[model samples]
Target chain A: MAESKKPDSSRRSERSRRAIYEAALALVGETGYARTTIEGIAARAGVGKQTIYRWWPSKAAVLLEAFLDVAEQAAQGEPLIPDTGDLEADLKLVMRATVDELNSPPYDAPARALAAESVVDPGLAAEFVGRLLEPQLQLYVHRLRSAQDAGHVRAGVDPRIALELLVGPLAHRWLLRTLPLTHAYADEVVEYALYGLAPRP
Target chain B: MAESKKPDSSRRSERSRRAIYEAALALVGETGYARTTIEGIAARAGVGKQTIYRWWPSKAAVLLEAFLDVAEQAAQGEPLIPDTGDLEADLKLVMRATVDELNSPPYDAPARALAAESVVDPGLAAEFVGRLLEPQLQLYVHRLRSAQDAGHVRAGVDPRIALELLVGPLAHRWLLRTLPLTHAYADEVVEYALYGLAPRP
Candidate 1:
């Protein structure tokens, strides 16, 4: 599954793309969203401005794709969202992966930088939610709906809101630095959420 | 109780401080965190750079105090944290008030600007979290502890982590633009959090 690529030209294109993505991530991590520009990215990547513009429409688009590439790599080329038969285990595994991603230096800095920038910039925020966050969230939506069909989750629950119960706490903890974002914390969130925080007989 | 007991010169200092605070907020809202500076605030408020420096150490400090003052006012002269005997009702009240403030023009724009700026800048973020976010969160911690005492929340529930269930969804919505933040949403978070999302008899 990993070796589905073609010949020499594709290899060069892949190399350029990887370089550009790394440069974009590093620049944003170093200089922030406002100061990281297309020109600067191209300069850092050893590509012309038109090279980047040909592939992506804007800096936001480039950065968004760069982040996706990073996430894809970190997932060990695993699909961005997985659908193992067990919904709770599947969700917990993904959330734990996310906690790991959010803690690691490369993913942590750039993602937080972009997310923080998006908090205020509505245009950038719209792009972020549309391209980056929502698609990933929709994977969970699909998973939860499947869970409902299988009777794992309550059929009455809004999958979107239900999904937030799982993801929101992690996102909240990561963004705010409120506490340690550990596998244990991720597992507890899953446990507390699936069983409910209230006492069970 | 709103009245000050300081002498004439100190009262003059108080007035200038208020003006500086107002100026800082307005400037940050208008131009965002990056563009806001002591010189602009001073110029807008018709105070000297020395005047701002005499009172606060940095632009972030000025903005922090400005936001704190606004929070204090929006609180309508109430305690920073409300502690009614009923825990759920008190939290619901505070979260609803938060929704109102987040939706209000007076608080929304400036707060968004500062929060966005803090995302990339660690120094600024630390200051923002320490001064503004943590103090407010402590109120909930105190209230939740009180609830633990009353046996409303589970005895083993960590107040800080538990409070996130209450605060996280709201913040997630507000920060991520995932949903319309409203009074209804606040009440829903309170319910979903205190009870569990799973089926309950």
Candidate 2:
């Protein structure tokens, strides 16, 4: 198994895969999801049409993989919510980083385009949820469950639903553009979510 | 000064306006936002294209007005958050109603279509937010501010941000199909929001 023959073939395959991902991302960003096609991606990537088909069953699959690659690259920092033994600090840090991703250069167009498409198209939406969104959400579920065990979160709280209190507000701000998604806004969301809006007993 | 206007003219105009709104809604639901043209709406509604132009400047304006009319009709019995002076009850009431609307038959298709388009198109999204979303959100802001005055919500809480804590999780659940939005979930969201996620002090 170790002596798999040629290194050049593997190098060439990796390069082709990267090119395809780049092409898929760029095309979807530029032309919107409905207009992006396998042939077009192949042409843009300088790969044959058959090469794309050989890997992905459909355009949705191609774009889903491309988006995953983009997200992995963008998520360069370690897992977003770090447990520094202080739940509040860890939550704020994670929320702020998420705010930065929403507001900044790395994820604006491609994410917006894909999210928009998913809203109208249920089949595509399912694929998106299955491939990308759920995995990221599961990370938060794991973190929140840990916090609950530590007595930082209430014992009865459902970690899955509770995690949304942290993530959803940020997403709502980003998607609706109801207000500026600043670090300040992110801090406010974290504070309000951790310590309830109602007065302390 | 009482001026006498013909009842026939007013009645005819009302009929035409209703027809146009219905046509626009049905068209947008069947065809996605991009393909819904003013001419197509007029054709479907049995009104002249000039009539639609006379009332609204663009297809966006027509759809905006049409969707608002639909929401207004859907919200006819929609209870405003009942402030039995209990902020928690009021917030839970409004959110539970919202979950019903999001799950309802009338709102699902057209609302989803508009939201999908708004994601990719910022200008349209702004209009959708301004004309449709912001005013509805302001109702919550108004209610929350009242609660702050009554000492239910903390005085320093920004009502707009606080409202997101209530709205965001529900929207997230509905949009992502993450979990069933039920009475129990609604109550939990309100409870967790009113009391801190950390054990109560």
Candidate 3:
């Protein structure tokens, strides 16, 4: 519902929710996941502890929702993967965007914090993959399925697994810091993934 | 370096070093990288805190050495990747072994701990990647270079980047727990990476 149409209380609630999200993201980025607490987030956001607890079950839940909000704001209603009947260009565009997003401080710090926590916490990891990551991955799956229909990708390719070939290298580089994550690296990943590493006959 | 030539004091020092390594690994696995401390490791290993400090400058250093020890034990002096004159087979063999290692508790728990820490700690991540991971990855570089010489791989391909296509997916799956990492999955990654996702003419 639009804020103008909503009651004053509902509008206030929306403002509070956004505040909470901002607080959570900022706190996690500054302090790291292990030290970020509900009380701390509440104090930072100028909201009551009960207000946060009523909305989210745990610190993880709050942080995850906060991350989702950040990602949505970053997306700004853009279609995640554009389909222009050219699979390579489409994938490269998305991958380049991803490279930019990863490099951006607003996304990178909080994401690294969440990812670090997820490695040790299976429950959080499951919720993260299910709630945030899988849905985003599904967009690629859909795009790849369209590619298969267009005879761009092979018929036998599993979209889920195939998508990883594109995303996995970027993630590996970003997480491990093995090398610089640049637009050039992103383009290389797309090209390498689409074409075989072996001598193409 | 043989124990037979060592004096009594040297032998005792060797035993204490082994104890310290075991204690560091077990502590990191049981608690986590953040909680695992020099004092805790020393207490667990039945050694003085000074002994740990004397040997390693920090917990990260100690844990890294411990990890190297575990990896050495796991390898059992076997070459990390065997060049059996079949690049695909060799890659698959190593990937499958990696799948098993990631699945195994002894390697998995401590590795997850170290990896989690590395995400937030750039210094540790650099050391982990440089001292431990890069050396292992270099084996693949060597194998791929050999393949290039044998006319199996494309001459233009950079083996370092090319190797990520194979290793990245497995690391992504293992770390994220997005899907079950298996020998079958490893084989598919090998096949898809070699042959590409697009159909051959």
Q: Largest TM-score belongs to which candidate?
A: 3
Name the runs in model 1 displaced over 4 angstroms. Answer: A1-8, A79-87, B1-6, B80-85
Q: Please provide, for model 1 over A117-187, each residue's C-alpha lDDT reduced to its tens digit, 9 standing for 90 to 100.
A: 88888888888898888888998889888878877776567777777777888988888776689998887
lDDT of 2: 0.85
How far residue A140's Cα lies from its native spot in candidate 2, in Å, is: 1.1
- Which DockQ values do the candidates obtain, in the order shown? 0.56, 0.72, 0.82
Deviation from native of the Cα of residue B184 in model 3, angstroms: 0.3
lDDT of 2 by residue, B1-47 (tens): 13246487777888899999999988888888999999999999999
Candidate 3's TM-score? 0.98
Checking candidate 3 for backbone clashes, the offending pairs are none
In terms of DockQ, which candidate is stronger, 1 or 3?
Answer: 3
Query: Candidate 2: how large is its RMSD?
Result: 2.5
Error of 2 at A171 (Å): 0.9
The parts of candidate 3 lying over 4 Å away from their true place are: none
Q: What lDDT tens digits, residue by residue, belong to model 3 across residues A1-201?
A: 465799999889999999999999999998999999999999999999999999999999999999999889989999999999999999999999999999999889999999988888899999999999999999999999999999988889899999999899999999989989999888888888888789888
Task: Say which docking band candidate 1 falls in.
Answer: medium
Ordered from best to worst DockQ, the candidate numbers read 3, 2, 1
Error of 1 at B82 (Å): 4.3
